[model samples]
Target: MPDGTELIVTRSPPVNSNGVITLTNRHLPQLKWQESLLIARPVNQFRDFFPEVNNQNLTEIAIEIKETYNDYLKSARSLEDLKNRHPELREPYIEVTSAKSQRTIYLTRLDRFGTLESVFFSQDKQFPVDLQLVNNKIDREIPNSLLAVATLDLEGKSVEQPIGAIALSSVEEYNLKAGINM
Candidate 1:
């Protein structure tokens, strides 16, 4: 782990096996890119990064983002409809800025094989984080695990490294744990 990076641990359910589970630990950097875009934390948590912006204004900016995304989804009946209703949605990425601070965040959406790829955001022209999901093959004795790697690029190219893994729980097991009946 690098300086100012925190480790996040998550559990992954076993696949086609008995009661075995895999746990993954990921390194999360405390950079503005991560704080402002990657994780789903409170807006106030990153206020220091934007000293000029107040908490209330930051909260409003967050709400506006959500509402815009919701509006995009609701009006996305067709490609033409999306382009006509919200011209911004037609672009591969969207850029938003804070009114008071003038701090900007760029959001990029990628898709492959009819499935949504990673949606990355950054506070600069170049993306700072590149994440990938990798499946790890294991023997019959051990539980299966999936690895999530985050490649951080700061200072243009001085520091870049892969850090992180994620585990998903089985639906049946999760339901049982939550006391939900099917």
Candidate 2:
């Protein structure tokens, strides 16, 4: 049973003949199903199509999910109640910054983008191999905290290390599935 708090599902803006966008109260079944029933599985499984926007502060989204989950828990009539009833949402927020610039060309290319991403490492400093060992530990021991895929190229100067690419998609995709198109 739904609690007293109403679940307000915002409808999408409809395009009119005159090219003006208009809002309506009509409910879209896709939106409702996606929002109310689609987030139960793990998100790391589908990481390719999602965007990586780490700067997006998800405090609002977190609060909303927390509230809804809290409400569901509170509304539970008993401990033996239905377990598979409500939606299971996942939160995976990934923030990635390249650790090193392979060469002057790579740095110059990155500079051309006009968006200076925050550096993950300190300036003019070298990270010990222990860091990589720790990452390997986390990847192997605590796989849930990270989803890493690394590769060693034929040339020793460059080894590819890609991490946290699927994290943000874990939440952003939920908004899309919910018809928010965020």
Candidate 3:
């Protein structure tokens, strides 16, 4: 059920030409199985890829990454200088400086070209999440309030922590099984 209530099917119902199954079960009287309410079982054991990001270790890592970038920016004369000094900082970055306040902001581009928003962390193989640094404030894009767990290497490269098995949504699993490339 859409409200998290489970109702067992008592009997097999016939499917019409429109691919709609009529549920004879009294619990959900006259309810036709709509595509939206369908919750198919996962192909394999479900593994939660999204985890709580409030851990002390992750917080410390975020702080460390921000501090390291700030330290490098403070000494570098320009964005090019920062990159040349820290080769670990990958490309496709956006650097902006305000003339009125002389405040500079640095952002690492994480989406496809011309896209206004960052891609979902799971879909992007490069940086797990988009990182933005403005003065002393550091911000990370958390799509749908879901955070992808990752860490920083010794050379300041982003390293995604191993997530056992990628869990796909029911529709995505079906598409994959049917040779679709969604």
lDDT of all predictions: 0.40, 0.33, 0.37
- The true-structure Cα RMSD of candidate 3 reads 24.8
Off by over 4 Å in 3: 1-80, 84-88, 112-182
Query: What lDDT, from 0 to 1, does candidate 3 have?
Result: 0.37
User: What order do you get sorting by TM-score, best first?
Assistant: 1, 3, 2
lDDT, candidate 1, 1-182, per-residue tens: 86989877797544553333312122234324534533335657776886775589867987899788767756654666645544434436433343544433322222211113323332335443344444433222223243333454555764422232122232122221221111
Q: lDDT, candidate 2, residue 41?
A: 43
User: Pairs clashing in candidate 2?
Assistant: 92-167, 94-168
Judge candidate 2 against the unseen true structure and give its global Cα lDDT, from 0 to 1. 0.33
The order of the candidates by lDDT, greatest first, is 1, 3, 2
TM accuracy, model 3: 0.19
lDDT of 1: 0.40
Question: TM-score for all predictions?
Answer: 0.19, 0.16, 0.19
List the candidate 1 regions with Cα displacement exceeding 4 Å: 1-128, 137-144, 158-160, 170-182
Number of clashes in every candidate structure?
Answer: 0, 2, 0
lDDT (10s digit) by residue, model 2, range 21-123: 2223233333543345434444466556555645446646756887887677666644224223211212222223334522110011121222235243223
